[model samples]
Target: MENLNIGQHISRRYNEELEDIRNRVLAMGGLVEQQLKDAMTALEKRDAGLAAQVVERDCEVNAMEVAIDEECNRVLARRQPAASDLRLVVAVIKTITDLERIGDEAERIARMVSTLVREEHSTRLFTQIRNLGHHVSSMVHGALDAFAHLDTEKSVEVWSEDRLVDDEYDSLMRELMTYMMEDPRSIPSILQAMFAARAMERIGDRAGNICEYVIYLVKGKDVRHTRVDKSG
Candidate 1:
């Protein structure tokens, strides 16, 4: 758990602000991560109470995002940070945006759980989606770990992992299509499952995006839309 030691400054207050914002980002990341876990558990267990809890926690996620944005704005306006400091702020902004989007996706997944549960879909049917949920859950968690350490190497590891998530999602879609073709009556519930799976896939992508931000924060290079070597 090595930090990049990014927040040091001559002014104590300025240093505190930067450190505070970074810590808050991690705290928000923690909350979003928990929301994702709760959502997935709710989906798997068909627990409407837990699903509702996930939806309710989304507002807290929203509030944290708003507060973090304001803190970044204050830093930008007052400090006018440059070089690595500016990049750190920029990366924080981008990371939080993705985290908030991930929260939204989790909320979407939680909402879809009720529909899938109502249909009483078999556990065997959720095979791919559940697999994907776990995959992306690890993706999201790895991404945060990388950010906490400011480790570009780990970031690339998480970045390259997105490929597997995509592959699994495609497989899930094909399976759902086959189910719909074989039994027309399953289409409605299957479509709900498909939507939930899509949300999981997007969550993986967002986790990759956070890794990109981590790389940018460390190397000062924007890696968006670029191929991250899995061999790295």
Candidate 2:
């Protein structure tokens, strides 16, 4: 039947569009992942040049977010996708927003690196901050991997790491406060380190947010504010 043929064509086209959106999201995720990695590398090496590059690349990340968002909107308007398709678009829109915030946090870290390069700071504190950066970077990568694979188990694993990140952040804050109190002259550098640590922790949170969106997409459940039962 001609009507049946036309239906098949439209269905195939819709699937193609969905796949295109997914690929674009993955591309955007890759860029954000690189931004976080480069920012940390620049911080560790005190490479101002690399930090500048990270900052410059953030504009590309921003543009990707805008482009993907527009495409999602267009798909919604044209296709009026139902059920799972609609959920996918909505989840991606939310995930992209979190990804953009993660990019912003990475940029903040890069700027902190620039300031830190000019200041004479404690080597031990910088080492700890670098360790935190490494942890958060791993979390980001895991989150993106989970999204790409639609693996709910991996998503939950990434989500569970957020508590560790928060604990490390608190411990670092206390240590930094002690340093500032003992030596007032170290306050400037310590303050920058504190800001960098906070940014790293926030990145972890954003990564968890992405994981939540992934779960939403796969399970059609809102787990953002609800407590996840790990016992099962």
Candidate 3:
């Protein structure tokens, strides 16, 4: 799937560095994926212990981002990669940034479970939020897969998933606002849920952003803004 051959370099060290950094990016992706899952599970199950773990593990994500970024910088300084190699380095740098922010969103969602007052969520509210969470989770996975393979088609599909995520977010937020307005007593708890959902929505956006970077890396197209309405 990948057009750029990472192992084609003359310097064995250069090839190893490129491959190692790619692996690190994937490892970071896996970590963020787990963080997102744990955070949503914590919210849905009201498991404070698991939520605390997610929050504490966030530092590991930050550290991975820093390490991979340093590696990318070193590759740029020493190898001075040109053509596709250059794009690969640039894409790795951008992907890790989004992954770190995704980790932050997960941490924020987990915090809501521990810090917010306990109020039983309405069935409808929980259902909508759960659906949104699942959709964003899929998008995140798809984004990483697209990047791993340099699959522009897969990247575009993941980018389009953002529209569905946004619609769900809007629907969920509207319901939450209505609930809050109807019962002022539930305002605090519902607000917490709303914020968590907002974080999930942002995760979807970031996942799509990562897909855009994949397209940039593969097709050399800067599609971030113009690709917003893309579905085909």
Predicted structure with the largest TM-score when compared to the true one: 1
Candidate 2 vs candidate 3: which has greater TM-score?
A: 3
Residue 170 of model 1: what lDDT?
Answer: 96
Sort by TM-score, best first: what order? 1, 3, 2
Instruction: Please give, for residues 1-232, the per-residue lDDT of candidate 3 as tens digits.
Output: 3467688888888889999998899999999999999998888887889999999999999999999999999989988888889999999999999999999999999988876525665334555588889999999999999988888889889989899999888988888999889989877778788889999999999999999998888766778679443332
Candidate 2 CA-lDDT value = 0.86
Kindly provide the TM-score of model 2 when superposed on the true structure, using C-alpha atoms: 0.93
lDDT by residue (1-232, candidate 1, tens digit) is 2234565678999989989998999999999999999999988887888999999999999999999999999999999988878888999999999999999999998997677666755455665578899999999999999988888899999989999999999988999999889988878878888888999999999999999998888777778888875343
Error of 2 at 8 (Å): 10
Query: Which stretches of model 1 miss by more than 4 angstroms?
Result: 1-5, 229-232
What lDDT score goes with residue 178 in model 2?
95
Q: What global local distance difference test value does model 3 have?
A: 0.88
Model 3, position 44, has a per-residue lDDT of 83
- Listed per candidate, the RMSD to the true structure in angstroms reads 2.5, 4.3, 2.4
lDDT of each: 0.88, 0.86, 0.88
State candidate 3's TM-score.
Answer: 0.94
* Residue 104 error, candidate 1, Å: 0.3
